[model samples]
Target: MTPHRPSQHARRLVAALLAGSGLALGGCHADRIVNEAYPTTYQQRHPIVLSEGAARLDLPVGGGAGGLTERQRQDIRAFAADWRKNGRGPVGMMIPDAAAGVHSSPAIRNTLAAAGVPSTQIVSRRYPVDGPETAVVKLGYVKLKANVPHPCGLWPEDLGHGGGDYYGASQNREYWNFGCATQANLAAQVADPEDLARPRAQSPVYAARRQTVIEKHRDGEDTTTNYRQEDVEVSEVGGK
Candidate 1:
């Protein structure tokens, strides 16, 4: 018995099916090409990172016979307060040898002590200086800081179309440098770096006010307090 051969119509149908499959595969490949991505959000791309850094203050000393000036004392006090709040380790003092005659380490130490810093927390090291009159005492302490690790203004990928960075150019999204400045500024403006990671604890509710509100609610009265205000007409500056 001769083997039954597929008819022309059946062969054509098989060809059509194979062509459809090829087109589907081509479509999948195209999708893969387009779906390549960099970080979609600026927060992911340029995140604010918390790290240990030195919070430093430079105090310029004038060769005077008197002790620390009022301004200098205030600066030391403020620095001491900041250290008390956020400092991780001892406060370091880079005392210049040139200013030794005018502004001694002992005087600065006393000032720091008066500002509530313990003598043990204040560490001093003498550094050689060329200019005695223009010497500056550098005070610093380790503190937690929030900042963006990646430096801005980098053109790692070409902005214009064409080249190896075709995917970035093709997508109508923000570039690598976009929103970087905003992120950096936000990090700088943050009073406490830790707040970026977690929200602060809620403050205690006012007991008296809460009691008043509860009583008002219980008595079916208005819970909100009303304040007297002067009557005013609506703005008619631009209306007929």
Candidate 2:
């Protein structure tokens, strides 16, 4: 009994050794994390993706037994131009199941045809109307659209809460929502969504311009073209 009791000094030594081991392990873990390849760039975190989607427009039909009004005609013509530009497959029309639709359907078809859309490519279907609500002719076509899959405005982790320590701002990394709005805006504003993934076909070269430049270069003349500035100067005080 009480023959072998560890002294306080021995206990302290054991505690110190354990603390040093823990620190060493923690250092190794931190190094591993730093070395791992992570998606740190905003572009990588929020990528613009191209996918198939629909471009739609609604044309309100007037109750009066007449063809589309002047404004409606212009709107339909513009919508038809868009379809001709980027539409895929057949251009679809979801008309209300009413007499107005029957009356305007032929006129709409004629307008679309006049705008270069083939009659064969125009498809129409009827949707039942419950009551005397406003009837809208829904025109839709499939097209390539760019978007971000991950929705914005979601904060999974509190930016201020740094997971006790060695996280969040301490790591000096981007948050989840960073560059999301930029990516979304770019996707929305891009004229051609497919351009995000790959380049389009090159346009035809300007033969006349190319020939002029070549002639100038061969004749030992300046190849650059200078245009005349015809606009009047706002201020001529500085020897304009």
lDDT of every predicted structure (CA atoms): 0.84, 0.83
Looking at model 2, residue 66 earns an lDDT score of 66
* Residue range 1-240, candidate 2, lDDT tens digits: 659988999999999999999999988888758664556788998889989999888877754336588777788899888888878889999988777776778888888899988999988999988754667788889998899987988666677654532444677777777899999999999988878988999999999999999999999999998977897557878685
**Model 2 lDDT, full chain set:** 0.83
- Record all residue pairs in model 2 with backbone atoms less than 3 Å apart, i.e. clashing: none
lDDT of 2 at 87: 85
* Clashes within 3 Å, all models in order: 0, 0
Q: How does candidate 1 score on lDDT?
A: 0.84
TM-score of 1: 0.78
For each candidate in turn, the TM-score is: 0.78, 0.77
* Tens-digit lDDT string for candidate 1 (1-240): 999999999999999999999999988887766564577788988999999999998877763345467777788899999999999999999988774533556777888898889999988887888886657888999999999999978767777657556666666767788889999999999988999999999999999999999999999999998976678567879886
